[model samples]
Target: MQRYKCTISYDGTLFSGYQVQPQKRTVQSEIEEALKKLHKGSPIRITASGRTDAGVHARGQVIHFDSPLHIPEDKWVNALHSLLPDDIAVKKVEKAAPDFHARFDATGKEYRYFVRLSNYKDPFTRHYQFQYGYPLDIKQMKAAADYLVGTHDFTSFCSAKTEVEDRVRTILRVGIEMSREQLMFRFVGDGFLYNMVRILVGTLLETGRGLHQPEDMKTILAGKDRSLAGKTAAAHGLYLWEVFY
Candidate 1:
């Protein structure tokens, strides 16, 4: 069997998420179905680097699966792209070592949350960005973000429903970049719990709005209480920037 590593980009606006769920449309299910069609009668299973929530987007998601077919690695990209939906595109495919597990081998991931701070929302960007009419203190947000960098038990930032026993994760970086109307919060971490990024963004936004102090982030991290953090931001504003091995 040959293991194929596939890099894909998807607009997650319509799908339930990345994982395959019974009776639900998902990126994994769609890709597996297309693979099954390509393989004729054989069953196919794809393993993704991580599961993205509904309405989120991905620019460099990675997955791997084993196939019995003898198709050339160079042809896999074009073949898969032709069969997949327009919203999902196969960026590249190559033969991977058998031991390369997409999830287990992943080293880090980068995510970005976009917010549009303006009086009126742009119709074109409505679906992709979160719109906030009030002005934000970008400097204050950055100050709070600095506290989030490095290793910490991010229990406060993660969703209460997360089943993971360990809440500790290393955040390599937290950066804020602003354009004329867009505010982007970029996070690079070893891994993230469910809704962790969104919650972090929300907390930062609260600080920006003067609802919370910049030093409050230190308290929140130490408290490890979900109630202390701000609300989880909308999923549409989040994007899986990339997955690194």
Candidate 2:
């Protein structure tokens, strides 16, 4: 059997999420169905670098699967594109080393959350961004973001339903950027627990609004209590920007 790596991009507005769930439309299920049609009765299991939640999008998600078919690397991209839906596309496909595991081999991931701070929301961009009418103090948001850039027990930032044993992870970087009426929070991390990024964004939003102090993050981290953190932001504004190997 030969292993193949596929880079995928999808607009996640309509699907349940990345994982395969019975009776639910999902990105992984859609891709697997297309692969089954191509392979003709053979079952294909695809593993992604990370599983994104419902309503969250991806610009560069990567996955790998083994297949016995002999399709050329270049043809795989077009073939899959023709078979898949318009919202989901195969960016590239190549023969992967036999031992390369998509999830296990990933070194880090980068995510971006978009917020629209304008008086009027754009209908076209509403699906991809969070809209808030208040003017955010960008400098204070940056100061709060600075406190999150290191290894720490992120219990306060994670969802209550997260099943992970360890709550500690390394955040490589966090930045706030503004362009026109849009503001974005970008984060790079070794890995994230469920709703961690969203909660962090929510807490920073509170800080930007002058409701929370920039130093509050330090206390939240030390508390390790979920109740001390902000509400989880909407999933639609979050994107899995890229996965690094």
lDDT of 1: 0.92
Query: TM-score, each model?
Result: 0.98, 0.98
- Cα lDDT, all candidates: 0.92, 0.92
Residue pairs in collision within model 2:
none
- Per-residue lDDT of model 1, residues 5-89, tens digit only: 8889999899998988899999999999999999996779999999999999998999999998898878998888888999998
Positional deviation of residue 209's Cα in model 2 after best superposition, in angstroms: 0.2
Q: What lDDT is reached at residue 51 by model 2? A: 92
Clashing pairs for predicted structure model 1, backbone only: none
> What's the CA error at residue 107 for candidate 1, in Å?
0.6
**Model 1 regions lying over 4 Å from their true place:** none
